[model samples]
Target: MNKKRIPLPWTNVYGLARTLVALGTAGTLAASSAETLFRPVATIGDYPSCNSTTAASLFCLSPDDYSHLTWLKWLCVAALLVIASGWRPRITALPHAYINYSVFSGIAIADGGDQIALILSTLFVLPALGDRRRWHWEQPQEQTPETRATRLLALIGISGLITLRLQMVVVYLQAAVAKLPHAEWQDGTAMWYWGSNLDFGPAPWLDTVVGPVITSALGVALMTWLPLVIEGSLVVSPLLPQWLRWWAMGAGLLFHLSIALMMGLWSFALAMAGGIMVLCLPLGSTIRLRADEDVATVDTSPSQEAEPPDPDRSAPSVEQPQPSR
Candidate 1:
């Protein structure tokens, strides 16, 4: 009897998710100066050497000079760009994770987004290591038989993905539950206060458009409580049906987009958007490869009964077709 082939974990769904994360981070770093990102003179509490002591950060390996640090920052941007391009996942996975770690550890300024990026990038390494595809966006061809080693690797990748899902649940759950104890969130005036804040609030033009709604009692209640509801719903989204999961994905993305518009936290919004995709998007979903229409015809059935080998039949080719660009 033939063994059922194990599906590889690297799919276009995850490919898009990781690409968003890489692009968001790369955009942020590429647009900023090294001086703004790295401190000119390292204090005892926050030093460039701290990154080295904490982990094998690329930035830490650079010489303690402004020019060297700038060059290092560009190097990270290039690596992230490669990751965003959906190139060889096996080669870029660890480098992507390392870049995030380096930024989190060495950057003078960072936020929750940076923390999330670090975690996601690290977890992505598991699936990437086992993936045999040239690009992450390519679906595994059905003709390829799974070897014992490949099956084991796929299992490891699935475990990592499940862990990532649970982590996202915890993140959303914590965000909602933590807000319950706060007076602003409780009284439904949180949106008002946040909108009117001097820093990190809505821009002047945006405030003009949304100012009235945020200040009103009804709008404040809806704006404030809606986030809690949405976040709470996301925490339990894994238990939801596939259709509901898609809705949750949409709602979660809209929520983050609003945050980006209101508070100018583009990187944060992008990071959370990626987290939402991993949490709610089904892993089995595949992208339609226009160049390779045959992918759609590939049988993904879990098991099929095998027939006895015939001496007259020839062995199938071991080679696989090249994936479409």
Candidate 2:
């Protein structure tokens, strides 16, 4: 009995990571646009047309950027999100693809590192990304010419993902560079300033226990060096001992969280943190980990192998279970 051993590079892991980047790019764009369209009113007096000008205003003083919703964008975003996750229909997935396309194009036109990566990836990369629709058809019971073509398309999707990863790497390096010249970053004082800012949410009182100077000093080194460690180490990320990468990723997540909190870049933090997780975790394990997490079983084991299949090639046909939210 010959059980075909597909190489790790060709497995479902890359599929998940790439999908996340695409999905995330789409999400980030959608959210940022929404915020732009529906930002908060400067003061309560500005809400005359918004609601009755009464003291006991039933509505939220500053609803989660509510005034920005248009039926069209919402509908389109809904369609895209569904398409990004749908299992049985490519048509449903079209909106997600279109949004991804738009994002990539927009990013490219902007010429910044993030946008450049976005444009390049969307144009040359995402066509091979797969969902259940592609994979289900390739199974033994369902294999057909149509299925094979879809699988080939999935390959294209994986190619886009490769560019997407390259894109993410560029962002990591660029951000690290941005923080390089600041004396505060070198001394950790910049992080302390960031931590106390209101945009990052209220500063926690607990920080008083550790003198601000000490905290700031530690923050400066962390702020300056963390990205270097993560981005530079990426060459060996999937190759180094799994524990080492995981440790690095966890630290990266913490750093991103601090960025989100101190600098008020929450969405950016989340997306970057998610990206860090995507890059650091073995490409082949996402679907399994997702599935296991859903069923309330957690796998804590580490993979010793360093070479994860390049999701850029094999990612498209892997199945998606349920959308995370």
Please report the candidate that would top lDDT against the real structure: 1
Stretches > 4 Å off in candidate 1: 1-7, 40-46, 49-52, 289-325
Question: What's the alpha carbon RMSD for model 2?
Answer: 11.0
lDDT of 2 by residue, 1-325 (tens): 4322211222334433334434545455466554343344455223212433332222223343445333333554565455345333333334444444443332212123234423432433243334444531122212223455555654565454455556666666676677778887665566556555555423465446323533565545665566567666654565565557766667777776665545444445544554565566543243334365346432322111223333332222233222111
Q: Lowest summed lDDT over 10 consecutive residues: which window, candidate 1? A: 298-307
Model 2: lDDT to the true structure: 0.44
- Tens-place lDDT digits, model 1, residues 180-250: 99999999999888888889778988888788898789998899999998998899998885557766878
99, model 2: CA deviation in Å?
Answer: 2.6
Q: Which candidate is the best by TM-score?
A: 1
Candidate 1 colliding pairs, count: 0
**lDDT, candidates in the order shown:** 0.76, 0.44
TM-score of 1: 0.84
